[model samples]
Target: MNNGWFYTAEFRDGRFTQIQWQRSGQPPQTTTLTFSSTNGQGQPIYTGAFQAATAVTLVDLSGGNVQPGSQVSVEVEEWGWARGNCRR
Candidate 1:
C-alpha cells in the first residue's frame, strides 16, 4: 500500500487475490475493489467487494510484475488525525 502497509500476495483457493491492508486493533472490513486488468488466464476486468482493512487487490491475479517504486498508486481519502502521509 502507498501508506506503507505490508500485505500478503495470496488468498484462499490459491489465487493472488489482493494487496490487502489492516491496522492493528481494527477488524478487517469489506470494500469495493477495482482491477485494472486480468491475468494471463483471461479473468477479465473485475470489480467486487472484498474483506480487509483496506483491500487494494487485483482480484484474481498476481502482482509478480509489480516492482517497488512502480507507477502503481494508492489513493487515500484522508489520513487520520496525527497520521501524516510521510509519517506512516
Candidate 2:
C-alpha cells in the first residue's frame, strides 16, 4: 500500500517541513504541527495544521513570511502515525 505515507511541505522562502506516518485502520485525524527550526534564510518557520485523509492530505499553514528569490531546504521527521479505514 503506497498510502502516500510521507509528506513534505515547502515554504515559499525555501524552507520545508516533512512528516512521516502510518495507519492502523482507525479514523481520520487533525493535529497542529510546529517547526522547531529555521529556514535556509535564517528565519524561523511557521506552524501549521496537518490533516490525514483518505483522498488527500491537507496542510493549513499559518505564520512566517518569506522574501523573494531565496533557496529552499527540507527537513524530514518521523513524527507519528495516523489510524484510519476511511474509504473516501
Candidate 3:
C-alpha cells in the first residue's frame, strides 16, 4: 500500500477525451477533459455528464515496470474529468 499512480479514462468524442497515468517512478501523465456549455456571456451552461465513480488501485506492467499487488483492480476509470461537475 505504498506505490502510486493509476489513472484511466477512455471515453471519447462526447466526453472524457483521454486520460492516462502510470507509475513506477512517474513519467506518464495525460490530460484531456472535453465538454463545453459556454457561459462567459456565451449563454447555455449545463450539458456535461458522467455521474459515477469508485476507488481503484489495481496495477501490473512487468517489463515496463509498475507492479503493485500483482492485481486487485478497481479503478473503473478516471482522471477526474472535473469529476461529476462542480464549477463556480
Compose the digit string of candidate 1's lDDT tens values, residues 1-88: 4454443332333333443456666665444445457657654333333343422334332243433332223333343111111111
Q: Answer with 2 or 3, whichever has the higher TM-score.
A: 2
lDDT by residue (23-82, candidate 2, tens digit) is 566444433345555546455543444454333222222224333333223222343333
Question: lDDT for each of the candidates?
Answer: 0.37, 0.37, 0.35
What are the TM-scores, per candidate, against the unseen true structure? 0.30, 0.24, 0.22
- In model 2, residue pairs whose N, Cα or C atoms come closer than 3 Å (at least 3 residues apart or on different chains), thus clashing, are 14-72, 26-84, 27-84
lDDT value, candidate 1, whole model: 0.37
RMSD from true fold, candidate 2: 11.0
What lDDT, from 0 to 1, does candidate 2 have? Answer: 0.37
Q: Which lDDT tens digits does candidate 3 get at residues 16-71?
A: 34446577886776544443344454322222222223333221212112233322
Candidate 1 off by > 4 Å: 1-17, 30-32, 36-71, 80-88
